[model samples]
Target: MVKFGYTILYVEDVEKSIEFYENAFGFARKFVSPENDYGELNTGGTTLSFASKNLGVQNLEDGFIESTLEDKPFAIELAFVTDDVGDLVQKATSLGAVLVAEPKKKPWGQVVSYVRDLDGFLIEICTPVEM
Candidate 1:
């Protein structure tokens, strides 16, 4: 059996990125490398991790596009399900997250919104979809 474990974002500053998630989402920090090139957060069952761009470059033979606030967000986004969509959006925005959309209720009865993290990574803040 296999399970999805962690998602690692390539960032300019690993430690700073870790701190941003901690402040915005209330996840506790797990570890940071002495070199400050990598870090992880205790985000429940699946870990959220960050690694420096330098590390990314070393890992991938071909180059990769780096995330920046000035550019449009990439195709993928990290989603966080919450009970209070409005409150979480406000909290994230308060910590410098750029609000992409206001919370809106879907036909399926879920409230959803979007925001971009400090490095321009898109994040979806939403209420869980009920089955």
Candidate 2:
């Protein structure tokens, strides 16, 4: 059987990235490596992990592309489901996140907003879609 365990984002500083998510979204730290080059957060269901770019270079002989302040964010994005999209969006912006879009009701009845994290990663904050 196959199951998604986590999503890893390659960052310049693992600890810094971990701290950013913790403060911006209230996610608790699960573990941070002794070397401070890798860390994980307890994001409820699937884990959110961070690995330093140095670690990525070591793991893959060929280096990987990294998000930068100057570069436009990648086409992909990470989304978090939240009931209060407006409040979360405001808080996220106050914590150094770039506001990409304000909350809006979709035709499907979901309120959604977008923000760019400290590292320029696109994040979608939205109300949960009813099943």
Top TM-score prediction, candidate number: 1
Worst 10 residues of 1 by lDDT: 11-20
**C-alpha displacement of 56 in model 1, angstroms?**
0.8
On residues 16-118, what C-alpha lDDT tens digit does candidate 1 reach at each position? 8998899999999999999999999998899999999999999997989999989999999999999999999999999889999999999999999999998
Candidate 1, residue 26: Cα displacement in angstroms equals: 0.5
lDDT of 2 at 101: 85
Q: Model 2, residue 59: what's the lDDT?
A: 96
What candidate 1 gets wrong by more than 4 Å, as runs, is none
C-alpha lDDT score of every prediction, in listed order: 0.94, 0.91
True-vs-predicted CA distance for residue 10, candidate 2, Å? 0.6
- Candidate 2 C-alpha lDDT tens digits along 1-131: 98899999988889888998999899999999999999999998899999888898899997778897678889999999988999989888998899888899999999999998888889999999976
